[model samples]
Target: MEGTRYLDSEFRFNSGRLSLDLAATVRRRASTPIDVLGNPNACGRWLKAAGLFSDVPELSAENEEALIRLREAIWKLVTGAMETRYPEDATAVVNAAARFPLGTPQLQSRSGTVSVVSDDPFATAMSTIARDAIELVSGSLRLRLKTCDQPDCRMLFVDTSPSGQRRWCSMQRCGSRAKGHAFRQRHELSVRA
Candidate 1:
């Protein structure tokens, strides 16, 4: 699927990690959140977009619920970890989900196109995401984990820039808006001055 398809869907993979990206499937967690993964087809699209599946894998209700459970746990764990703590319940969920094996990629046909061959795509994807969350919460990257500073946006992203000073989810998205708003406010104040 085209990467730009995110503009048409509720999914955004810009969170900088598979696990955080999954957590972001539910937008605006602190406010009236939106569940973009509303159905099996949507979940499949997410898995495919995340590169966990080469195609839209058939998702079962049970697996979908499990996926949501893992996503929620990862969100809680990451947020709590930011405060130098990890919730015991969320940690347990992540630990259990991480036990599942990740999807295995295999070459297909003479085209040699590679695809994840998994008997249970949900389990495999969950494992991959859970492992990512585990690393983000416990490894050096935790120091770089940051939430967007935009007032209306609270997104968790890793500061992968060399200077490690990224503060917004996307400079084009939130930074530009905030800058313009600030500029407008300054102009108004200067007018009064």
Candidate 2:
């Protein structure tokens, strides 16, 4: 699908968590935001690209709406956890999502070797993301949650660095741009001085 190309190039998964990655589907949260999931096929493409599905699942309109609701719930939960005030509704939404039956991994033996494959990949992927959100919010990983520092960027990411001093969603992208902007400002100030 044409939408698949957009997802491949634009979707950022540097968040270290699927829930956060889903939240990043919307760009520029503080300003004019662009909902990357606006396209009907975008969700299916996203699931495939995220390694959540071996084959793209057909998503009806209702399914798309449900997915969007889940994504928003994840965003709200993460925001609340970051602010140290977990919203009860957001927590409930995440818990309900986790209650969905995840795909059963079945062992496949072939040529004297064994491999595992999920029976219901879509459900498994969504449930896994929900569970990960639960862990991130209530587990020790909560302290590592961080939103990108770039004014125009509103992606959330986990600081997995050894020192945990990371401030950008991606150093090669937002970080470099921020650093370059600062350098230019300093240079302009020096010229005036």
Candidate 3:
């Protein structure tokens, strides 16, 4: 806490879905935003992590720009869906992206491993994410989408937990910190009393 600042070197995949994970690349959009997908390589890393491709796909600056544009549109659509207000532009972007062809999963008999390959990996990844978003919004899981309760987090997530009472994006970070803060405030109030 003294000197080491939090670096945005790695991609975050905690949102539980491809589109949501992509949406999480840029954090705190309302205030100071931290963009984890700062470049094509980062985007490729995230796609690889998402299991979109067996190997990391080559991405260009244009790909990065397109990805960022789609990510923002996805964020808008997701938040709008959460509020029961789907933006026209966002809807169009996601719908168009979803229409793109997805990667074909081939079962390699040599290794018996399924690898998703595509003539255009970028298009495949983008379409896959957009399709996931579409399904998430149109399906029953839309009711479970929730933003993190931590004031500074500004993260969106699905409340898949039993009882559907999940709040923080990460219990170890936001939930624990919030609980500790409340405990400290309560203890201080008791001391004052």
Candidate 4:
């Protein structure tokens, strides 16, 4: 969530309509609205809407068992951005995304036996962005990015700040909180003296 600010609005459709949809899904991590969709939840919805798993009825069966796993994998990838050890392998990344509400994902079998494989179905949907997330955490990926320092806010944002010293997710929201706190502290100190 904290790294989403690094994304570009123009990128929503940059690679075309589908890519734009994915970008929009990824960008939801930065929104603070009542319907703010987190990375995990959005990933699930995207997979179904994108019809990536339609061929396998079991994949979308019984309350979206497969979708849940996919969402968890995505969450891990986003949360891992703040960690010292970025996931090096696809398994690690997939595991991270599968942390949300998940279940046994039954993949279609060529032999007529649906089975769950370590290879996450959602990972295929995420293949487009996993490398970018890894590169970002490893410092190999660079963009005009910044993280909001607001204690209650974990949103990531693009630094459109003129000085690029912006620390809050948005000056209109988190910025006011920081300023109000600083003002209170200054008043308390003056009163003590």
Best by lDDT: 1
Model 2 TM: 0.90
True lDDT of residue 49, candidate 2:
80
- Tens-place lDDT per residue, model 4, 24-117, is 3333344553221343344344454554444322233433443343334434443455444444453374545435332255756576756434
Tell me the tens digit of each residue's lDDT in model 3 across 1-193: 5311222236667787889989998887657888988853777777777777656678888888888889999999999999898999999989988888887788998999887778877887889999999999988999999998988787888889989999988898789999999999999999999
lDDT of candidate 1 over 109-137, digit per residue (tens): 89988777777667878889999999999
RMSD of each: 2.6, 2.5, 3.8, 12.1
TM for candidate 4 is 0.41
The C-alpha TM-scores of every prediction are: 0.88, 0.90, 0.90, 0.41
The predicted structure with the larger TM-score, 1 or 3, is 3
| lDDT (Cα atoms) of all candidates against the true structure | 0.85, 0.84, 0.84, 0.46
Question: How does model 3 score by TM-score?
Answer: 0.90
Per-residue lDDT tens digits for candidate 2, residues 1-193, read: 8956766686778889989999999988888899988976889878878777776789878767777888899999998899898888888877887887766555555555433356656666777888989999898889999999999886889999999999999999999999999999999999999
Q: Where in model 2 is the C-alpha error above 4 Å? A: 1-7, 111-121
